[model samples]
Target: MTTEVSTRPLQTLLAFPFHEDRWQSKMLIGIGLTLAGMIIPIIPGLILMGYVYQIMHRVIVDRGSLYLPEWDNWGKFLKDGWRLFCVAFLYSLPTLVVSFAGMGIYIVTFIGAMTAAGNHPDSPASILLFVAIGILFLSIGLSILTGTLTFLVLPAALGHTVARDSFSAGFDFTGWWKIFRANTGGFLIALLVITGLMGLVYIVSQIFSMTIVLICLIVLLPLAVGFYVMLIGAALVAGAYREGVENLELAELKLAEASIVAVQEEKPS
Candidate 1:
């Protein structure tokens, strides 16, 4: 029987730079293909997003570092994703409502502060400080909340079990301090690296003429980064779940295998 344990760290879904598995390479290519497909004008971005999740779901099931399904598989995966997307999207409705409310409050606070200070807005430094602080706090909170929502809803659409659970599961996972502590450092490091690379790309692209072509290319650079980061984030979460939540380490699997063999031999089989 196949063990349900997750694979090794170097072989996890994140497909980190050091990962040498063929599946990892294929998954990376798959992500690139999905992103390129998304950039097309007429096709709905949701279609491609669905495919990405489908591919990810298959990867998880295969227990491999990468998963590249055939073209037909892509179609089926997209359909499955669409079905799940509807459910997850509906589940996320409350989050969307709250987000809108938060934005409204944020805008209102800033406007009210400015209006209270009147034409001499520069005079009330305290008001300006309060407004700035509120904006910063709101932004940080939104960033974490949205990031958590992405983890909860997106993968479930792709076939992860958590998506089927109540909406509270998403908040619970995100609020779990142990999970945060385990994965936050790696994510921040990835963010800094990607940011630096994008910065360099932007600088190099700007060396060309300031025509529409250059501007569009510059815009595409960040989109490319954004797509990669999403995959990376998914991978990190997959890794965390495999180790922390599922408790399915490769070493434990090997030990179990050895134990099974010893037991069989002792049984006179």
Candidate 2:
């Protein structure tokens, strides 16, 4: 008999990074790379994101293993990171397009409003100004909503893509959607847990920032916390995916068994 894989989002979130004997060194490297990425720019950041993707991939393949992976294979990290970037970029395109369009409308209307105000103060210039302001605000709200939804959906998409080792899998909305629907509760819980962890880190960072000496740590502290949080979040997401997929398989199996039973009953009677 096959043992059932259980979902332990909270346990995995808090323990995965520290489960290994060399967790200290591993975490240090991760945090150091994150800081370096912040200082240097694109390349290191991409590599780090790719490393996080590996964590997700590992969890899925290993049936939710809690050990942190060693920081090796720079070439693979860079390549995988590029794929991660592409996935994120494509997902974010809708928000970007909306934002740019809104900005364009706002600019044109603002200019018209100013031009009209200069010539005819009592004309529709004020109305145009109001419309522009309204559009800008509306765009900002839409962008935020779209961006948040994208962030929530991204982990599931990335998990599917990473599992298949295919960049195109990230774009398979119908596929991921089915997986996501299978365990929406699990995904939402993971999201809430990660969000809470980040919020707690932010609060602590703010407290540290208040001190003169500790204020110096504001930069390093958040980076370290954020890196760990990323690892934890990735693991949680992968676990959720595993649970969701297994649930789907089990459901299908039960359906098949029921159909077989029904067919046998119909034939004999």
Candidate 3:
């Protein structure tokens, strides 16, 4: 008998991080991403991100089991991590560029406004105050909206990249849109779940400072928590993407069966 695929988003989301089956191995991977790799004084954090990307790839495409990633393959982890970085960097670029450009424009215009106010005593002080307030509100509003959008679409986009095994796949708008449409609610919940988990990780790391020694806590707790958070994020995303992939597989299977039936009907009796 075939095993029932764990495609339910919420159940899939909880399984990787919390399931008793392979928790120890998962924790070891978290260490490799965080504390263990940091021993080399290189960008282990980035390498860890790549490692996380591989896990998402396995779940979304290979339908591989969700368990701890083996830490033995340093080279492979770094390469995959780099690919993940490239994809995410592309996703985040537009917001970064717009934010910088806006801030630059605001600074230049604010300086001009200040100069004008000084030169003309009749200038309304309220105008300067309004611009300051406007810029503040604008910056905050843009940040929130952009961040939410980026996070909301991230899992689907990343999943597509993994499914296709190419960086270019991340930009496949039509493909990712279908996946996103299939799992809208799952993606949203994954985003919320990930955001909260990250915050909790940070808080735990901070709390350790008071309860434990500073150097030891920093060396041990934070990086471990960071890696664990990364694992959880992957699980959450994989859960959402699983729905799309399973649907896609089912459709393809049905189409194949239909084609087979048509061929038989066309055969000479």
Candidate 4:
């Protein structure tokens, strides 16, 4: 007999992190690690990221289990975190290149416009200014669009990488796209859920900022909120991935293949 797994995105996203018996302790540890990451920079940050990757991995393997893993394996966390960082950095390259190129062009055009205006106001300085402004807006628009698309697609890419336990898996665009297309709605809902939660966190942080006495919390609050949000986001990714796998019937196929391999190995050996 097998237990049925629930891949309902809303429930998974909202309840998974808190369903465990030691949830508060786990959350506090996560928050502390996150705060330490922010305070100490690169190494701690990578470990935190790796820890989040483990969360995603657990969800995917266990079919969205509610139990959080203890933070005992620092070495694994560091390695996983490094893999995640590499994948993220590679994905972000396009956006970074576009943004830098746009900024460079904007700076040149603005300087040209200013030079024209100073040298000859009656000349095509107005034209140059208009061109500069247009370029600026276009650059800004393109950057935002590129960045937004990257943001939306990255979680699935990360999920794939972790699922396969290979960094190269993240670059398997075709595979991830099929997964994304199979359950586009689930992915979008996950994205929207994350965005809404992040916005709420920002608002709460801002409210805390207004209170002078709680000024110290203004710094710590965002870090804690961001880590918690990351956990929720990771769970959502797992849920979406589970739904995608089921929708594509990959899980059963893999299981059948595994059973066949096991039988063949037993008979031959």
Root-mean-square deviation of Cα positions for candidate 1 versus the true structure, in angstroms: 9.7
In terms of TM-score, which candidate is stronger, 2 or 4?
Answer: 2
Q: Estimate, for each residue in 65-118, the C-alpha lDDT of model 3 and write its tens digit.
A: 776666677788777777777888888877786677667767776787778788
Against the reference, the lDDT scores of all candidates come to 0.52, 0.86, 0.76, 0.84
Ranking 1 against 4 by TM-score, winner? 4
After superposing candidate 3, which stretches have Cα over 4 Å from the reference?
Answer: 1-42, 124-129, 203-220, 251-269
Estimate, for each residue in 1-269, the C-alpha lDDT of model 2 and write its tens digit.
89987767566568767779888998898888888986798888888878987887877766756667678788898888889889989999999999999999999999999899889988866689999999999999999999999988987898888888889999999988888988889888888989999999999999998999899999989988998888888878888888888888898999999999999989955
- Highest-scoring model, TM-score: 2
Model number with the top lDDT: 2
Measured against the true structure, the TM-scores of the candidates, in listed sequence, are 0.45, 0.91, 0.74, 0.82
Any idea what lDDT model 2 has?
0.86
RMSD of each: 9.7, 3.9, 5.6, 6.7
Q: Candidate 4 residues 46-137, lDDT tens each?
A: 88888888888877766656457788999999999999999999998888988888888888988988898888888877587788778878
Models ranked on TM-score: 2, 4, 3, 1
What are the runs in model 1 whose C-alpha is more than 4 Å off? 1-43, 73-75, 83-100, 109-159, 162-216, 219-246, 249-269
- Look at candidate 4 and give me any clashing residue pairs: none
For 135-167, candidate 1 gives per-residue lDDT tens digits of 757765875687576544443232333333223
TM-score of 1: 0.45
